[model samples]
Target: MGVPTLVCAPHRLLRRIEAGYLDNPYHNAVHAADVLQTLHVIVHGARLHVHYLDPLGLLAAYLAANHHCAAAFELLTRHTELDVLEPLSTADKAALRKLVIELVLATDMKQHFSTLTHFNTVHQLASTKSFAAAGSSGEGLLKSAPGGRLANVQQEFKEALYADGGPDGAAFASGGPDAAAAAPAPLDDSERLLSLQVALKVADLGHLAEQMEVHKRWLAALEAEFFLQGDLERQMGLPISPLFDREKQGVSKSQVGFFEFVALPLANALSSAFPGAQPLMECLTSNYRHWRRAEREAAAAAAQQQASAAAATAAIN
Candidate 1:
């Protein structure tokens, strides 16, 4: 509704939608549902009497959903939608699309610290304002939050996350920046803009806190695709991760890397971000840890059973 100065760009948008579906490992219909549900939780948390959330709950969530276009590329693990953003017109339609795209693009793992820092600052500012206007016991964030404290923490967090400097050195930023890089932009704007950006941020990370079965499926899909991509890299003699040691058969040690270096930390960090999210985060944490513990248990049990079978075979032999 906010895309003024333009009527519609169905052709371009449709192309984007199609590419989003094609490229994302988890950006399909299921991913859409997960993101929407994540928004619902955030919205409800803000609705709580203790944390009224400055009445920014629902709209913020929806804004995230609409901005899902940018992450569609990385999550999909493929170059499924880069071309379409070009056809989008200038004026307001392009402007709104660009806004949504920039925030969505910023959700990359490489930007997590920086984005969180920004979020913490703005969040603190919003929180402090809420406190002065209405006391803390009633809603949203910590009541004890101090004014301007948000900005400082945010900066610190950003430096901590991105301290190595530039995302180019990271595995996650391999795709590079998206179309939103054009003309650059600022964070200030209308409620429509803020709501959308906030929503996109949470939605971008929403899947980390979903049902185990759901998260498992995403893991499986991405891993399978990751291996395949790694294989292609080997065939072309490109610089794929060493784990891919693809010259040999079977999946590489990369899955362990995924489990240890990626999923585990992601689950831990997400839980700390939202107190209301503890339960779901635990479930996800358990699931992420399953491979480590469960595999051992299963192997031990299998070994005992195999011993019994060997005894029987030897007795007959």
Candidate 2:
């Protein structure tokens, strides 16, 4: 915030970031902008400014939202686009760079379980402290100690993250049985830093919390990107990932799975942590229902086609 002389730094950096993103339907500058806007809404709506975050925290959150694809961007552009840091003092630049990198990397889907586990542990500890302070009577919890109530709400998110075999469960792991074997290592800084990391990760997937039309457009863009990947995979003679295989993967079906495994859990966790952001959970639920209905319709159409084929064969016989 102090780097007044470098007012255009963000714009220049965003330009570089935008150029780095591939010309895919999704994972491009527009999606980045969408996430940034959503992050602003969540931060303001939840009144995070009034509670846990400081200036640095807010800056990191905004950077994380806009540059969640920094790793991919770097690979595509062969540059880090960190020139914006030039405006700050050397020490401050280094610290901010580190924070930005950590926040961006936390958005990787592979880290989902580990990140949730760490956040859950922090939430649990905070809840324990708040409950002890509240004692047997939870009567004056919010009225007496607002911070304690906030902590409890944050801790309650852990339940949603791990509910009904969430991202951590055997079903979602790509590493086979060995994946679930390693427990999440305890995070050292179970404080503001951890909360910010969790918040940024949730914000990166903020599309799932948007209104129906916005969510549908983003989903279509993502599906188109996936199809493009499938095309590349075919050209390279490599096996395409299931969701990326346009021939085999139905957008509605794949989206339903994505919502179940990733979006819903994240939205629920964030909503629990920030009660004011509960509307995000509602949006996620609505999206899920929409996708589920689409999936059913797709399945019904396939079944009808198969029945027609069977009847034609019977008539020929």
Candidate 3:
């Protein structure tokens, strides 16, 4: 009834996220929700005919949605605010709570290296085999997703993943755990890692796939968070994001850049690997254009604000 785990599980996880995150811009619960929603879209698409439906995938999606929740609970338990979550239990809830936590930890940016490598070397092969069998059966290949820019996106996905060196090796390395470890990395163009990266990246940008109004609300929330985080990071002497403020480096950009650069390439690859999934690729491709245009317009707005501030100062002087 109602996903059984929805009752207590969310509350517990939120506790951990709220505590640990204390409200960061990019990695909060909203971002987690976006990832899960993105995964849902991919899963339900007619193309990419995944067989065996990756139990891990479903588990991971649930975990992503609740990652912030886990952090919230961590904060609560640490502070002995345990009573705050008393109303959420149901046995199934407890089990899912545990399950969700494990999966969430596994999804951490810190584990991306080993996680991504394993995905390329192992999970990719296994999943491919599984999909192949499903296609070989009478169902025949995926029926092609309903209309969308699935093909365009798939092509870009393939280019990024299947590239000779592997997507701007430097770009991939700069993300997640590998950031502090290495220097001038080689492009990996490894098919496996690309696929996983694509999955995570799409999840990061899933907010765009939402209904326009819902999507706008998410953008507002994210913008508010970015400003908050930027101010806090400046006060704390931390890095600022380029997307938010190129002049200061407190994580100025969200993963939207990743979507613009990476999504289409990875989507293309997926389409090639599984011909029936063309529609997903197309949707992703079109999505990229939208984000790129939005970025340009946003930059203009910021410039206008700066200009107005300058004019006010000049008048005062």
* Model 1 segments more than 4 A misplaced: 1-16, 23-33, 44-95, 120-202, 242-279, 286-292, 295-317
Which has the better lDDT: candidate 1, or candidate 3?
Answer: 3
TM-score of each: 0.46, 0.69, 0.45
| lDDT of the candidates, in the order given | 0.43, 0.59, 0.45
lDDT of 1 by residue, 173-212 (tens): 1212221122112234542344334444555555444454
Give the local distance difference test score of model 1. Answer: 0.43
lDDT for 27 in candidate 1 is: 47
Summarize candidate 2's per-residue lDDT along 194-313 as a digit string, tens digits. Answer: 555666676677776566676678778888888888899999999987778887754645677777667766655555555555655555565566667777788999999999999999
Which tens-of-lDDT digit does each residue in 1-317 have in candidate 3? 22222224545544455445445545675566557655655444422214412333343343456555555445546755443334445564465455455445545656644543443343334345554544432111112211232334334444533333322111221222211221111134343223434455445555554444555566677666667756677788888654454344322244356554344434443444444334444444444445556677899999999999999999999
The candidate scoring highest on lDDT is: 2
For candidate 1, the clash count comes to 15
